[model samples]
Target chain A: MKKIESIVLAADLAGTAVFALEGAIVAMRHGLDLLGVMVLSFVVALGGGVIRDLLIGATPPNAVRDWRYPVLAFVTGLLTFVFHDTARALPFMPIMTLDAAGLALFAVAGAQKALDYRIGPFIATLMGTVTGVGGGVVRDILLARVPMVLAADIYASAAFVGAVVLVAGRRFGLSPMLAALLGGGACFALRILAVMHGWQLPKATPW
Target chain B: MKKIESIVLAADLAGTAVFALEGAIVAMRHGLDLLGVMVLSFVVALGGGVIRDLLIGATPPNAVRDWRYPVLAFVTGLLTFVFHDTARALPFMPIMTLDAAGLALFAVAGAQKALDYRIGPFIATLMGTVTGVGGGVVRDILLARVPMVLAADIYASAAFVGAVVLVAGRRFGLSPMLAALLGGGACFALRILAVMHGWQLPKATPW
Candidate 1:
């Protein structure tokens, strides 16, 4: 149990760091001030988990109640702000790879948490997808852009698939750790392929 | 107790209806499809309460668990969609008045709910302001517009003041009903004055 908890914590923190970097980069591109960059990074790193926890009746969400998460987010934000130009110059492929990793980790984490809270399978799946995409949706909204989840990409779809896999695997008696690995791996692979192929959801037929 | 509950329910439903109308109008202006219109109306009507409920450890969110809220939102959306031209042509003052009423009711209701949940006065006040503005923030985000709360107006300020008044009044031994009435009335009056006078918060100094 201790080992599993440790692994989950490590994965969740790593995901937070990567998403914070992604949010900071977008904030910089939009020419937001230092404070704005920090806000965006914090929101992108923790917003999804907060939403998921709140829905599951976790009052004073871990993002708010636990000191470690915000510390990690703010530190990541500061580093990104200080190294904005260097981060911006990094190759797009590496950034996408990191983003995919974050997405997978969040999706699995969200689904597992929902299950732990005894939420129904359907709601758990939806919660997982929200955990994967909620932060990015918030980041985009702050920047006055339509949420990418609703507008384009195969992003939320990947998260949904991963969540379903995790929940189904658990029902079939797989260990939590094994289910997480399988779900995260599937999400990561799917996101990478979608990016490479320029895949997107079909839009509403032009109003 | 039942009387208070009934009053809260009526006010909440009224607020939902008005915000749904506001959201539908914005969707029509943006030329979104029917699906988009319904989505926006639903979000705008229920987003605030969802946020409030989640923060206070209310699971599943009343917005999702309760049938009446969504029904009211969808009905309002459909009406707006069908009478798009007529709604669009209506004078701005009446719409603004209706919006102010919703904002006031949400502010008081949120603060009251937070108090019921035994939250701190300061946090309750903040929650009230969130409940007042949260739906509109979601609506603006869906339209790719900067949230009006952050960008301009005395909108959140009015809600904050009203919430503070309610919390303080209760602390001083006022009944919940009386506090709500005073708080909501203050918010409504302040919002109307701000609208009429074009009052706004000063923009942050550049960078």
Candidate 2:
């Protein structure tokens, strides 16, 4: 149980860091100064989870409770600023890979939490997707740009797959850890492969 | 009671429009094109409340619940783009005044909701201020600029005052609407005056 909890925590931190890095990069792209970068990092790391917690009546929320989220965000922001040129020079593929891992974990955790609250699977799956993409959506909107996930990408779709897997695993009586691992792994692998192959969901059209 | 509810709803819509306008202006200042302007407007109008709701356990949130918010935002955004030059030429003072009203209303409403959920006074007040400034903070950050309220401005302070007044009024057995009105008025008046006189709280020493 302790080991499993630690894995969850580690995944949460990893998610926070990747989201923070994404915010910092967007800030840089927009020519914001260091303060702007740090603030965006904080938003990207904690914004969605904060929202999720609030909706679920989680008081003070994780961001305010676990000082680690803010600290990690701040550190990520500072590091990005310090190594602006070098960080930016790294190819986008590696960054996307890291992001995929974070996305998978968040999807699994979000759905799991919703299930713990006894919410129906449909809402749970939706919440999972929201939790996974909330920070990035907020980050992109703040930067006044189109959110990357909403564009032609498998980002949201990959998260949905993970959420469905988790729900299905539970019905099949899989252990929690095993289910989470399978769900998370599927999400991560799907996202990475989708990015590599330029896969995208077709945009829905009313016309 | 029904009449009063209508009034509150109207106030919300008006606030949405005013905030949307403020967003468009900021986008113009940043030299954003049409799509950027629309996106900024959406963020500035709904970002704060969305964050506040998420924190307080409001599901699907106002952004999703009240389709009017986004629709109003889009309309004002298009209007701003179509009449960019005229909108730019308008005096800043009136807009600032309207924004002050919106801030006051949102702050009081946010705090009241938090208090209704049985959150403590300090946290309630924090939520009030968050609801008031969240959108603009997101807006400015996206524009690669410092948040207006945090910048030697009396913005959040005014919201804090409003929140406290509401709490105090409730403690004294005042009606909810009455307390909210008093608090909201205090916030609006103070913010307007602060903007006029360039008032601001002392910034804490930069660690």
Candidate 3:
């Protein structure tokens, strides 16, 4: 139990860092103030988990209950605000890989949490995907872009697959850590491959 | 107890109808399919309550549990989808009045529910306002418009006031029915008056 708890916290914090950087950079690009940058950073980092928790009836969402999350998010935001050019200059491949890893961890951990709440497997899978993609969706909407997950990318689809695998592993008696690793690995791999191959959903052909 | 439940349900359904109509029209303007219209309609109508319930740890939210709510929302959407022009031709004043009443009921009922969950008063007021405007905000985001609540409008402000009144009345031992009437009346009056007088939040001056 301790191992599982630590693993989840680690995943959450790591994911928070990745998204916070992206959110802060976007805020700077939009010409928002420091406060706006911090707020968007926090929202991008933890909005998904909060939404997932609410759906599963986990009140006082972790983002609010734990000081570490907001602190890390704001600190990351402040740093990004101060060095926006550097953050923007981050190499695309590395950030993309980190983003994929974050997505995988969030999916696996979120599915596990949903199962702990005794939700049905199907909905739990959805919860996992939501945990992975919800924050980014909100950020995109705030920026007035079509949510990336709703766009051509296979991002949420990868999360969905990871969630399914995690749920299935648990149903088949796999240990939590093992299941998480397998699920997360699958998601990470799929996202990377999708990016490398430029895989995307088929667009509706112009009539 | 039964009285309270029915009253809340009435408010929920009534608000759902008003929001569903608004969502349907927006979807139509975007040229969404029938399915898209229905889905957006459901989201707009029930999203606020769903978000409120999640924050208060109400699992499997009432919107999901009560068939009546979704059924009514979808039916309204379907009718709007078919008779869109007629719905669009609705007199402005009547629709605006109905929208205000719906906002009032949602604010009062949502705050009461938050109080029932024993959330702090300040947060409970926020929950009530979220219940009044969260769905519309989401709808706007999907439509790529700045959320009206975050824009220059007295809408969410009125909801906040209504929620505060409701919570305060309950704290002072007001009867549930009386508290509901007092809070709802205040919200309705404020929103209508603000609309009539073109009240808005101050805008920033351009340099």
Candidate 4:
């Protein structure tokens, strides 16, 4: 149990770091002030978990109560603000890869937590997708742009499918670790492949 | 206590109806489909409460658990959809008044709930502002626009000041009803006057 706890913590920290960097990059691109950059970084890194916890009735969400997340996110944000030029020069492929990893981890974790809360399976799956993409949606809204989840890539859909797989695996009596691996792997692969293939949800033409 | 509960319920229902209408009007102007209009109506009507509840750790926020809100919002939306032309022809003054009323009620309710949860006055004030403007933020985001709270009139500031009044009153041992009345009246007056006088928050110019 202790091992599992440690692994979960490690994965969460890793996701937070990756998402914080991504948020910082976006903040820099948007020409936001120092405060704005830091705020956006924190929001993008931990907003999803806070939202998920709120939906599941967890008071004082872990992100708000736990010091580590805010500390790590803010530190990464400060570092990025200081070295924005270098951060700006980051290649697209690596950033996208990290984003996919973060998305997968969040999706699996959200589903796991929801199941523990004994929420119905359907809502739990939706919660997983929300946990995966909710931060980016918020970032886009704050920046005054269409959320990518509703517009550009098949991001939330991928998370949904992954969450479904995790829930299904759990129901089938698979080990939690095994189910998480399968779910995360599926989400990560779909997101990466979608980007590589220029995959997108079809939109109807303007009337 | 029963009287207070009924008043709260009445205010909530009124706010729901008004915001739902507002959301539908925006959706029609944007040429959203029927489904889009209904979804936006539901979201705009209850999203603020949901966010406030989440922030204060009230899970399955009242808006989600109560069937009345969704039903009211959707029915209002449907009516708007069926009479979009008439809805669009609505005079701006009346709509703005309704909006202000809803905002005032929501702001007071948000602060009250936060206080009930034992949140600090400072945060409770912010929560009030959030509850007043969060739905509109979500609505504007769905339409891919900058949130009015950050860009337009002194909307959120008005809510914050009103919340401060409410929290201060409570701290001074004032009755809840009196505090709510003072807070709501202040918020309503500010929002209306801001609209009437074209009051706006100052923005820093680009370098």
* Per-model RMSD to reference: 6.4, 8.2, 6.7, 6.7
Q: Per-residue alpha-carbon lDDT of model 4 for B1-207, expressed as tens digits?
A: 998889889988999999999988787677665655765797789888888987787777876455577779989988988877788779999999999999898898899899999999999999998888899988887888777788778888888878888999999999988999999999999989999899898889966
Q: What is candidate 4's CAPRI-style docking category based on DockQ? A: incorrect
Task: State how far residue A164 of model 4 sits from its true place (Å).
Answer: 2.5
Report how far off residue A46 is in candidate 3 (Å): 1.1
Q: Candidate 4: deviation at residue B25, Å?
A: 9.4
lDDT of 3 by residue, B61-103 (tens): 7665555777788888888878876877889898889999989
lDDT of 2 at A164: 85
Model 4: pairs clashing at backbone N, Cα or C within 3 Å: none
Per-residue alpha-carbon lDDT of model 1 for B5-87, expressed as tens digits? 88778878888999999888777667665545765787888888888887776677877455578778988988887777777
Looking at model 4, residue B204 earns an lDDT score of 90
Per-model TM-score, in order, reads 0.64, 0.60, 0.62, 0.63
**Residue B114 of model 4, lDDT score:** 96
Candidate 2 residue runs with Cα over 4 Å from true position: A33-35, A54-61, A203-207, B1-132, B135-207
What candidate 3 gets wrong by more than 4 Å, as runs, is A1-8, A202-207, B1-42, B52-60, B63-137, B146-207
Worst 10 residues of 3 chain A by lDDT: A198-207
Output the number of the TM-score-best candidate: 1
TM-score of chain A of 3: 0.94
TM-scores computed on chain B for all candidates: 0.95, 0.94, 0.94, 0.96
Chain A only, candidate 4, TM-score: 0.96
Report the C-alpha lDDT of model 1 over A112-192, residue by residue, as the tens digit: 888888777766876788899889888887877777675567788889889989999999999988999999989999999
